[model samples]
Target: MMTEPAQNTIIEQHINLDDVADLNDTNPLELLVQATGLSKQRVKDAMTKGAVWLSHGKQARPLRRKNARLRLGEELHLYYNEQVLSETVAKPELIADEGDYSVWNKPNGVWSQGSKWGDHCSISRLVEEHFDYNRQTYVVHRLDKAARGLLILAHNKEAAAALSAMFAKRTVEKHYLAWVNGQFPHDSITIDKPIDNKPAKSIVTLKEYDADKDRSLLSVQILTGRKHQIRIHLSSLGFPIIGDRLHGEPTQSQDLQLMAYKLDFQCPITGDKKAYQLKTWT
Candidate 1:
């Protein structure tokens, strides 16, 4: 028996199977119920939404299967985010509807995909809830939670594979609009820096400069998709993005001044060039 989790609780903990029970082989759901004191249904729901992970030694992987049997000394880690637990939900604005793939303008404060507890606060879960439960949604790429802009989601695995390959091959072009602190010297400058030991390149073109306010607007195009590449590259160059707390001084607004403005790629299913842009944030 289990009630609902409190709205403000965020759980991230690892529990070992050996510490909980003496059983040789037991399912993760049973262990989770014992570990978190959550109901069986609550544990099951968390696993289904990708809130759990299995770790043994140095190997850790997402635990999606509810009935997965645990080995001795293996740890079941639970991650529950409280932000999505709020009743408020952000809806994505549909930009285009291709048969195989769909483009949406994911709003700020919304996750591209859901976590264990934040499934309802994500675009991928919303698509599945509104469209068809039987239909599968695959995330081709991810957008920062604080950034608002154009995004694409694949409906099927085949389309997902092809679209993911497009990104991997660097055949896709992404354009972003960023608001930075201080005035940039060059109207056109390229930042070639290595992020996480991988080569990352970004071309920053000064779009609008407000010297009086010490603010600058830039049009950035990233040649490589590295984690926090744009923000890291710009911060290293002295002009940190305004409102970015992770890489720069935090602003009062707290809203990151970054937007995925445009995306260009060829439709893998139709063999036609496709380009999508959102003028809302620009």
Candidate 2:
């Protein structure tokens, strides 16, 4: 039988010039900054700290200058102490579809959209990449990056306008599931809070309980769309969602345990009930 190699073994080798020549085409500082998304000063500081390594198998010392110049086949090892930007988009399965609108099951840790540079992975980019370019796409609403569950997308301008109006008008029904920190006192409670001049209402129903963990699972229905409405409302009730950084009981976990589990809306064009439910639960 063959034995597997040790995990910590470091394998180093000498390669031909053509392999790393493209790295020399750009300045080292520029390449490092682009690769690590660090400022020039930070890169220089790393160099001073012996964090940068050259092809000659030499660690960059303080006396060593910070230059971008390199010969062909020179190996560059950069030690970055930051999270690397994700380039791939999270593609959720399409649940429901209309002429110009569709619903998807968005998983946790995926952004709904990103900034102009497209430096970060996002759901919008994923949809755009999968759909026809002639059609315009827009997010009718947003879910927190850490929150999972159902999300609605509009394929064209008309669909976007209609769905946006539905959200603004409070015609769409949104339901969520949250694993909260403490036991809820009441069986059901309605929260009416003003969010950004819009009246937001949520009906929370306790579903399950874990006595050992002192936690309760809740089914939350939102009558209005507001940024962090469910999370904020639950937090205000003193039973913040477990693992929620913004509102949860502070410990070590920073991820929110809330999920947008279900969405029900009337299709603007088809006039049919558009309901989407998430099959996966974490």
List, in order, the clash count of every candidate structure.
Answer: 0, 2
Candidate 2 lDDT over 94-113, as tens digits, reads 77767587787777777887
In model 1, the runs with Cα more than 4 Å from the true position are 1-84, 132-134, 280-282
Number of the top lDDT candidate: 1
Give residue 33's error in model 1 in angstroms: 9.3
**Which residues of candidate 2, in runs, are more than 4 Å off?**
1-84, 87-90, 132-135, 195-198, 280-282
Clashing pairs in 1: none
Tell me the tens digit of each residue's lDDT in model 1 across 1-282: 656677667777788777866555667777777667777776676676667888899987668787787788788898866454443567888888886888888878778877545466788877776666656788999899888898889998999999999988999999999998788888999999999888999999999988898888999999999988888999999888887888988644768889999999888788899989887553
Local distance difference test, each candidate:
0.81, 0.69
Model 2, residue pairs in steric clash: 28-68, 243-255
How close is every model to the real structure, measured as TM-score? 0.74, 0.65
